[model samples]
Target: MTTCPLCGFEFDGTALSCHASCAFNERCAVICCPNCGYQMVDEQRSVVADRLRRWLARRNPPVREIGEVCALTELRPGQTGRVIEIDAENPVRSERLQVLGFVKDAEVYLLQTKPTYIVRVGFTEVSVEQSIGAGIKVLVG
Candidate 1:
């Protein structure tokens, strides 16, 4: 995955493939972020740097939640959860939810429960009607 340093769009990684017959082509160590077209050098590792990177990667694991299991409709205002799954059996519906950033392990918060289920995911708020909201299972304490 490539994360753009400029726009923060985490999309597929696009690497520049050199077709030119150059002596340095095999030794080129660069990665380009697909979203913003930003380029950065892929580390040409020294022994010490490699060791340090491995250690650091091990030291700081990504923040994740085991999540307290619960239903989305049951959550009151101000409740939060990591979206573990959407219970919709239809693949299209599941894909739709994923596109809306309702995939597994995404943190979500209930902003309101009246009229519709208004929830916040990341920096965006989404209003889901009861039929849809009921199928969205969340992991909240």
Candidate 2:
């Protein structure tokens, strides 16, 4: 199933109709939204490329040891762990977390969970939305 990048509707990728006036529909790799008429380049190939790049980029994180992996929200106050992954679908959003020292291999401590998630990464305490917390996976020792 392909999701409409605009309206967040899930539908078959083969069902999208491209209304754009591009001259190369035969070679074009784009998906159009059926509901809102939004068009986006199909990123399946790019995702594969990204996966290959990540595989070659860095040494495996220290969090690779066998253990149960859970989202940041599952951590209680005073709990600590190493960030193993962030499940964000957008590169910009993932980079934003990286800027805040929430990247893989970073140590984090859960400071609070009420109203929102407050976690300490490095020397900074960051307030994060509950939904965003769900995207951050941590490896607890």
Candidate 3:
């Protein structure tokens, strides 16, 4: 779980938003200061940097990479396949993909990959260059 850098309040690791009434919702994840009721977003670059460092550290653990199901539309061009493993770290990308209603545990397939790899998910085909990351459970048949 991540702590509110501004208020020192602890929250769930997967939580992105603090609350609806938070003032910093426009800029960052809303985190309210319980003492002053000051609604703010944690914009500390160090926090992000630290998180990245941690991710890099855990990446080599050899966990069940791509063991969870995922959708085809979630894959994008020019992104590293390893991205899916760190979905929470990439909120912008996650949000973009989530808009399409594709989440973990969806089925997809790799079609072609020369100039760009095409992925077949559901009823559509998407071409991307980035590595789709691990932790996705896919069935090949």
Candidate 4:
């Protein structure tokens, strides 16, 4: 069985071999996951890559639940969460926030939520207004 890197779906490669009729089937080593349609190279075709993938997967399992996601402002004081999404109305503001350490997958710790929302992302502590804090979503699990 093979596991998808993106969605963690596992299945036998041959079960989804509907790509046999494609023009590039002979040269293409890609396999598409039935669950999420994520195309990835078939690891069996490369022994080195297969071994590395297995090793990495063992170190960090591909399968993991995203858990509950909510606005950063919803987190209670002293709570920590993984930043999942930033719903900034402006693209420039979203990019700015990312540069300021509010990027997705970054861990955010709620320090306070009174006059302003104080969050610690990595080693940087940022004081944000309620509107900005509400735009940042984090995984609460």
User: What C-alpha lDDT do the candidate models reach, one value each?
Assistant: 0.73, 0.79, 0.47, 0.81
Where does candidate 3 stray beyond 4 Å? 1-88, 131-141
Task: Please list the Cα RMSD from the true structure of every candidate, rounded to 1 decimal place.
Answer: 17.1, 14.6, 17.0, 15.2
Candidates sorted by TM-score, best first = 2, 4, 1, 3
lDDT of 4 by residue, 47-125 (tens): 6688898897665423223476778877778778899889999999899899989987999988988778898989999
TM-score of 3: 0.32
What would the per-residue lDDT of candidate 1 be over residues 35-89, giving only the tens digit for each residue? 5667665564235557788998875434334465767876777778888779987
Clash totals for all candidate models:
0, 0, 22, 0
Residue 21 of model 3, lDDT score? 62
Model 1 stretches astray by more than 4 angstroms: 1-67
Error of 2 at 68 (Å): 2.4
C-alpha RMSD (angstroms) for model 3? 17.0
Candidate 2 residue 29 C-alpha distance from true site, Å: 67
Candidate 2 Cα outliers beyond 4 Å, as residue runs: 1-66
Q: Is candidate 3 or candidate 4 better by TM-score?
A: 4
lDDT of 2 by residue, 1-141 (tens): 988766898878765555568676555567777777777766653465567668855422233233568888777777788899999989999999999999889999989877788999999999999888889999875
